[model samples]
Target: MRHWIWVVAAFVAITPFTVNAAGAEPVGSAGALISGKSPDGLGTWTVRYQHFDGNSPVAAVINDRIDDAANHEVQHATWNGSTRRPWTFDATGTINVRPTTVSEIFVGQYNTDEPNMPMQSLGSVVCDSRSGTVITWDNLFQDKTSGLTRLSAEVEARLAPAASSNELRDWRRSGQFAPIDVNFKHWVATPQGIELHFPPLQFGRGLKIVTVPWASMSDQITPEFVAITE
Candidate 1:
């Protein structure tokens, strides 16, 4: 499952929005910010990624924003080695990259169906061109490095300006969390890249909002971008 050639874009749905970054607050009632699942509930997933280098390792195209309607129908997964069995949304999701050591490049929706099969390593990021929006994750497996290190140090101690009113009830009681060893291990990188804040996966009863739009990469050798399940 490694077919490459993706260039489909059109995702605009991010309501109940908030993000000013000063002393933020008020992110409730979007069904409580993004809803729970990590106290061993499994599947309520959330992951963010970014990677790119100078001379050009070829990685460009990043647009993450899709608010509501469970991220408005989208289920894409491509992690060749293991875990790729969740297709039933129909929008678009692709990650047919080729050069691994564990650094940015992960498509969401975790239940596993078998694609390349190789998950259990959640840490590694490195970008070139004077790193800016810093990213760095390392061998995170101890419950996603202690629950994203207590959720990135308590959501960066309330990043204010907007977006945080009990932060959607603290993501429906603990940030739609998940990372009690969902079986992911091994990965590396550090040119600069790492930012994972996952939480949104239920499939029934409420929300499964999986935003994260557009991402591109090419080493040449494509044909494996599955995320069209409607």
Candidate 2:
């Protein structure tokens, strides 16, 4: 717990936010879009950006919109070091649009009462441009039921060796494992196939990313998904 205090302190020290000295102005406005690209040209993306907005109702509405777009739940807590201050909402992410598909990734964090515990998670949304529809794991499979069955088996098999590892052990102890169905919402389209992003504590601290090659699941994949991802 002592160690966590330091961790939380560090996060607070670095998290960039504007403070109003007179407390008359809103801490910051919401609903800004930030865009960028990888230096190597591998990907280009945009972030639906916002900063900590002090308890303004307008800020709350903007926060809700950001949360809904990212498919994340709001985290509540007392702002550290200030009992008068209320919890604030801040979220940002990237959307990479390719010729065939679009991949969006969002990371969110909020202060919590637990020492060193900031509620944080990552989520992704992939879309097939041709159909102008969001792609789900079920959409990729010819036999959705059987395909999920196989995917679960394969993912478990791949992770079996690491069952005793610290992260997996913690996750298992916490009873968060759902071996029957793998979450497919957080994925990115690639030339190889699709890369899945599992956030911290789902598999471990830090992000757990696995590339499921198209060759491995070609039989199960629908032609439409194949055309988009490939």
Best by lDDT: 2
Residue pairs that clash (backbone atoms under 3 angstroms), model 2: none
TM-score each candidate. Answer: 0.25, 0.57
Name model 2 segments beyond 4 Å from true. 1-68, 71-85, 157-184
lDDT of 1: 0.27
- Residue-level lDDT of model 2, residues 80-171, one tens digit each, is 22232223334465545556665556676654344655556666666564444667776778888777666655655666676677656666
Which segments of model 1 are wrong by more than 4 Å? 1-147, 154-161, 172-191, 197-230
Task: Please give the CA lDDT of all the candidate structures.
Answer: 0.27, 0.51
lDDT of 1 by residue, 28-67 (tens): 1111122222222222333322222223223221122212
